[model samples]
Target: MSNGKVYLIPNVIADGTQEQVIPAHVLSALSGIKHFLAEDVRTARRYFSSLKLFPSIEALQFEILNKDTDPNTLHSLLAPVFEGNDIGIISEAGCPGIADPGSLAVKFAHDHGIRVMPLVGPSSLLLALMGSGLNGQRFAFHGYLPIDKHEFSKVVRELEKESRKLNQTQIFIETPYRTDATLAALVQVLQGGTLLSVSSDLTSANEFILTSTVAKWKSQPRKLGKVPAVFSLLST
Candidate 1:
């Protein structure tokens, strides 16, 4: 219910052979409606620049908003179309509002009467689950966990418990710098016989999808360093 015809754009992943593709048609359809509130202005700007598409700066369109912006000003910046303008929210990558700043904007717009339009594209988490061959029908996408070691441990324990009780797949991610540590913690803490699916650098040249018990996962080489990734676990 976010106000004023909101459009959601996705960022596609590139395999070694295939090229990276952005939903340019999504942009084309958004012609003249140039109010884009992006998560990372730099990344968004890079995206358009890579495509050689110059956006209408007159409409106050560009990608480069701060993540720590004031709630009121943020809402005002992303307010749904009042007269005749439409707002577009794009994540640094993938679907907006899933795990990006756009969620706040979307909620604010909805509270006021702004319409939200969600577009489909590559989602690393979704893709990981799809190919995980786990309980796809019942899964939870727990966005990045707290970086605090103790807090992260508690979160993992709770997720493990929920996964066990609901027979659901718990999917979560950590910052790239903490990937190895996260895996090590899981290996040390998770109960025996727990099934884990760790995917690293997915859809890229160094892509790796591995499924094993927590004990076995510890033996594999570390995941990609300091980059985005998805980690999934399933219970018996």
Candidate 2:
């Protein structure tokens, strides 16, 4: 019933902004995809409900692919599609496999000779970069830094040194809720004048960008809300 393989769709919801937005285009693009691998079925359904457009998702077919999903379950779920159908894998928000789930599906798809196509959509990584004013010619998405303060500090120091030597832009994120603590740590531990760029609520009405030295960031009492965000640092 299919040409076996999984496709990663970003569906970068809501103007592709990180502010709890879901763009209409994401669904429109995948209207033909009867089968989808959702990170969370309940949440995904609710999102669809908001559009007042209901697709008989359960009738179509599905493979539950969450961070908590087991590897064995994934294999069996994907096995039936001996001729793999084009699966639309979605994250809770933004692109899948970019700080999101679907890594297992992608890996398995690759091993089984199933084609994997990633559809273009909203990505916080690029969104922050575009406004950061940092040299985009070269950059790196280092992802979330370690939670341990000591390890995180060490990692930042190393990244700072690495970027200086390589002339590369380094990016990272903290759990939305723990933003204050993480920002505090960076403001305190990072070298006094380290240039850092932070973008919050990217693509939303409340969107904001702050580019300044660590010292200046510390001086400013502003705090990032629970909105999606990205932080970037580059060598001067």
Q: After superposition, how far is residue 47 of candidate 2 from its true place, in Å?
A: 2.2
lDDT tens per residue, model 2, 97-126:
887768888888788777787876677788
**TM-score result, candidate 2:** 0.85
| lDDT of candidate 1 over 1-236, digit per residue (tens) | 32367777665454322235455566575564567878677666566555445554443576444568678786557644664577777776667777777777777767776677787567788878987888988999888888777887888888888999999999988777887777777877787678888777767777778778876766664545666668899878
- Residue 5 Cα positional deviation in candidate 1, in Å, after optimal superposition: 1.9
Candidate 2: where is the Cα deviation over 4 Å? 13-29, 52-58
In model 1, pairs of residues that clash are: 2-110, 2-114, 2-115, 3-113, 3-114, 3-115, 4-115, 41-63, 41-64
Range of the 10 consecutive residues with the lowest summed lDDT in candidate 1: 12-21
Count of clashing pairs, candidate 2? 9
Against the true structure, what is each candidate's TM-score?
0.84, 0.85
